[model samples]
Target: MFALGCLALIVLPLLGFIAGLVMGGQGAGLWGAGIGLIAALLMSATAALALVKAGRKR
Candidate 1:
């Protein structure tokens, strides 16, 4: 899970940017940024939930 989160945080945005550039449009950059942001938020939420759940066991 940690590795997945790390991957999403790093690779997701890089892939998005490359894809956007390949596609080529006025809003291509925006699309990549949006994708990156959404991925980041999702990963963060997952991580937070995991932490909370783990803490409750104590």
Candidate 2:
């Protein structure tokens, strides 16, 4: 469920943007690129936080 949620939030939106770009143009590309950047940043932060918590457990 968690994995699915992450994929939906982080992957699908980016895919949408790419598809839009292919079908549309620069504006769609820019929008998708922006979303991809934000999703990547958020996923990176989440991974970092999880690593910290795991490290503290040891």
Candidate 3:
């Protein structure tokens, strides 16, 4: 469940960014893609931290 949530967090933004690039043209698409990538990275980091904390607790 946790993994699925994290995966969704990472993938949804990426898909949206790709869609934006296809429909919105270069400038807006680049901005959206940058934001999406940053968001995905942040979510991935948060998930990794949570996993580490969980492991330490056990």
Candidate 4:
């Protein structure tokens, strides 16, 4: 889960940029940026939730 979060935070934007390059449109870059931002938020949220759950389990 933590790894996934990191991937979301880092890998997503990289992927998005590459995708934009491939697609070649004004909106593509924006869309990629949007997706990347969303992914990063999700990643952080998921990581925080996981941490809480882990603490509770302990």
lDDT of each: 0.79, 0.71, 0.73, 0.80
* RMSD after Cα superposition, model 4: 2.1
lDDT of 2 by residue, 1-58 (tens): 3354466566756785787699788798778767776776677668767867888994
lDDT (Cα, tens digit) per residue for candidate 4, span 1-58: 7777877878787778678767977578768867887888888898989899889984
Q: Report the C-alpha lDDT of model 3 over 1-58, residue by residue, as the tens digit.
A: 3575577676767776787788897766777777777777777777788888989984
The residue-level lDDT of candidate 2 at 3 comes to: 58
Ranking by lDDT: 4, 1, 3, 2
RMSD of 2: 4.5
Instruction: Give the per-residue lDDT digits (tens) of candidate 1, residues 1-58.
Output: 7677877887777777778877986379668867986887699789878978998995
Stretches off by above 4 angstroms in model 2 are: 1-17
Q: How much is the lDDT of residue 12 in candidate 1?
A: 78
lDDT of 1: 0.79
- Comparing 3 with 4 on lDDT, the higher-scoring candidate is 4
Among the numbered candidates, top lDDT falls to 4
